[model samples]
Target chain A: MRGDVQMRTMESSYSTKEVTKVPGWHGLVAWDLLFNNLTTGLFLFAAVGELALPGLLAPVAKAAYPVALVFLLTDLMLLVLDLGDPLRFHHMLRVFKPSSPMSLGTWSLTAYSLPLTLIVAIEAAQALNLLPAGSIVLEWVRKLAVVVGFLPAFGSLAYKGVLFSTSSQPGWKDARWLGGFVANSALMLGCAEMLAMSVLSGHSKAAASLRTVLMLLLLLNIIPAGLLFAEFHNTLSRLYRERQVYLALVLPFVGGTLIPLILLLVGDSAPGILGAVSLILLGSLAIRSLIIKIPHASREK
Target chain B: MVIRELELAGLPQASDPPIGPLSALLRRLTWPFRRGRAPQPHPATGFYTDTTVCIGCKACEVACKQWNQLAADGLNWSGNSYDNTAELSATSWRHVKFIEQFAANGRPTYPDHADSGAPSREVTLDQLLSGGGADRWLMMSDVCKHCVAAPCQHACPTGAIIYNEFANVYIQRDICNGCSYCIAACPFGVITRSDFDGHSHKCTLCYDRQRDGLVPACAKACPTASIQFGPVDELRDRARKRIEELHARGVPEAYLYGDEPGETYSELHSFYLLIDRPAIYGLPEAPFNPWLHLIGDYMRTIVSGLATVAAILAVLFLQGS
Candidate 1:
């Protein structure tokens, strides 16, 4: 009996070596994040530019509006497809549970999408002479669009980070600063997007102003990005030690921030500006994908 | 005088008569609608899995599948260990994990005799199989923890995962949209989506049996009584007593996992008794609830948004000046 007891104790100490192999929120989920950030970022840039620098940047904002609208629709489709039952997607909206980040997100998307669609429709009508340009009614509609689109745009931008942060996975949960990081990334990407659009459309004055705004956004982004790195180093040192850290964190820092800043300092050529914007976009996607790939390190063993 | 004596003898007693079976059944059927009567709470039921006496018979697994009508997972061997089923899934609610231990020197870790003081014990696998040697085999039956404060419940967007009448976390099949958020939120990694149905599934704790006032099939079929089922409070008491008894008998490494609420989530309704650290059993020692960290994350996001606004304003101001 004593030998039996000892054997049982020893056996309990042996490792089960069971690793959960479920593919969590990959493929379309990552694409959804990219498209979501792009939509929110672009809409925000357009709305703010239209309000602040109407004379200089209004045309650039108008050009970005339809593209942002298309991206938003794509994101919504991707979100539904990722669900196990796409037909039941409306069930998420039946109840409002603040405890659930996904519920908050669904509502945010709805709110953001409505005003955005109105803005795009009005813009399209104006371009086609369907609605008289500079009419007081059209001006009022644009102003209303700005008001309604403000909170939800930022909410949609930040909620993706909230969604990931609320996961039980250690790689995500411990990084409380991820929300700030993602929000800042969105802001940087938005400015870069507007800058690229203005440059490509031959609006040199608007492009120059957007370049300055992009530089300011990048400078501000460093705080949250640095905080994320510090938090990851302190909490998930094992992950910090892995090569994924270089790919996700270091590469993004260099390609997204450093290279873009250098390009802005150099003479404003179309290729240089476009290359810089493309690099930032690539860096953003890389970070999002990396976050998805890194599993919560299984407890100590 | 004769009439008065007859009347006294004819008087019957005033006691109520016994209820008939038909009337009892009628009363039961109508009990819910009876006015002003409060609903009675059912006793909280859960599993008390004691790993000490588990013999790896796999009877509980068989009984669970038979009772739940769960389909077979397949007969393929993993080539990893004696465990053929691998891990718990949507179909396999109950899984038996097998662990075989041997020292680096090819010697059995457990000595044949307790009197032997040396760490090295020479016992071959053949001798161990004969019940005369030092090899040790540990088998634990794993199931859904049924946490008191389930993250899956909080994370579910449609409220599909909820506590049933028996205080067990139940996934409402029809309501489940299969967002798979619960799968990510579950700290134990117990919940899984069925390939055929695309809905999340886990152990229901034999809720139907509990409704009928019967023990779960796995607990009932366990030959060694390793998988004990009863009221949670009673099971907790029994588990404590058993732990003490084991300690007295020289097995001091015994401890409970998910038995009490700690830094992780709330106490688990169905917990375990184990002789090793939780990680050895493939359980997290310190599981974090994502909700716990939400406030800080949200605050940071708000602050970052403000900073972005500040940057934009600064750019505008610099250009204006």
Candidate 2:
């Protein structure tokens, strides 16, 4: 019976001939996800950092909020660039669809942008001494930005995972753990970026703390990633069976995940940590692209 | 050969591209599709493509292209039999996929239909060694399934992909931002992004013609009546009777695909009658809509996401101060 099934499947060439790739969301979507998580990670890091390690993190995070805002704008820009007819971009805001993950994510991005901009504005004003640092009004505004920012942060953070998982793509379907996976990925990438930032500015003490956190994240990220891979094993394993796909993905794993992981584990050198951070960023971006690409791009005719 | 040599030498190979400014302008001027009768309302309709009777004429394919005025998929030979157009795409909306699994000359490279999941009808080596009619050529004039619960509709963040009154899944090109979300959302691989224009395209199920109370170009042009278009309910009934007739005629393998709703994937507005499993035609044995896990996916995110946040906090707390 199994052989018969195989024969029919082989005869049909069903695996090879189906609509191969997603029409357009390939390279740009990857960038969008990266930047999305990058922005989210920075903010989330600061949010947790303020409470967890107030002395070391509070001032730096305050400094990084502007950078996170920039990363977020780029993410939104990439989202616009990914559109088929970008001129018709305004149509996205015409509806408030809860059923569609993409719709919800877009709205979340929009919702989050306002508070994010305000947070940056407040930070910038205080930095430039436009507003008195201890003024009651500015403090209230800052608090408001943080409060208004909460729900949308959680919503935006998980939307991409749901967006990818709740699609008809073979590898993506039924992977309910994807939303959490996105969160984990964001944290991993965020920590890497922070470690890199600390090393660059010669904040060895800050780097030490960030390094430990990043190492822990890299270790634990395996759980959700492992589960996702197990869920996606059937599709991914099949894709990996193809020589071209195997070649395409191996680099991201080795350079992105493996090498950096080793460097972080053993090395305390600033340059080594920076190299690990850069490689992880590249590898992470590549892996995200591949995740989207593996299903959307057709290797076979 | 010269282009390859030049490319290998890292020299600019000046090959005249297929799509250049001159050709594009010429195509625009010579656009030949007739603007059919002014649009009007029609009932919910669909195509019942019976692959058993398809003769691979490709008249439907040509008619579809002519009526739609879609660009030719170029002169490249697929080297995969007469299926030069390949699968349905932004340009080639109606495609005839030719699955030629015939025995080469006299030797059978595949198993005989003995184990085809039906009644016991086994073939022996005696029959196989001899020149037997081991020809199992399948031709499906493929088009959009236009699913009842179209995943593309759910995936379209812009709400550009919608179900018309005819229940045909339609993409409003004007509103579409071409996010390609719908392209990924489709299980059948029907939607595609056009190279000419970045926007994704697929069969509109002849929405314009249907509105004008006319049968779609492909079904109308099918000489063998293999592609039948009519009200979906009536078509479903006809399909049932036809399948029964095929089964009674000793073709027990015949079955309807996407004719009914499954656990996750819903019914297809446009369906097919196949003599073999759907996989034989590059279709999944059981295609699922990712939207089925909509709530579950979000719920899982809450659990996983919160836990990760807590982990981040714990990690920071331990290392900080």
List CA RMSD, all candidates.
Answer: 12.7, 8.9
Cα lDDT for residue A80, model 1? 92
lDDT (CA) per prediction: 0.78, 0.76
DockQ of each: 0.26, 0.43
TM-score of 2: 0.82
Off by over 4 Å in 2: A1-16, A51-56, A174-176, A198-208, A241-273, A296-298, B1-43, B104-136, B318-321
In the range A1-301, model 1's lDDT, one tens digit per residue, is: 3345444444333244423434346778878998988998888878877787788778898888788989999999999998887767776776677778888888889999999899889988998999998899897988798778989998888888887777776567667888898888887887888899999899998888888888878778888878877766644456456675566677878987889889887968989989889988887787787676656343333
Q: Model 2: share of native contacts present?
A: 0.69
i-RMSD values for every candidate model: 5.3, 5.9
Candidate that scores best on TM-score: 1
Two-chain DockQ for model 1: 0.26
Isolated chain A: TM-score per model? 0.89, 0.87
Name the weakest run of 10 consecutive residues (lDDT summed) in model 2 chain B. Answer: B1-10
Clashing pairs in 1: none
* TM of each candidate vs. truth: 0.85, 0.82
For every candidate, give the share of true A-B contacts it also has: 0.51, 0.69
lDDT of 2 by residue, B19-68 (tens): 77898666544432213353344577888999989999999988988887
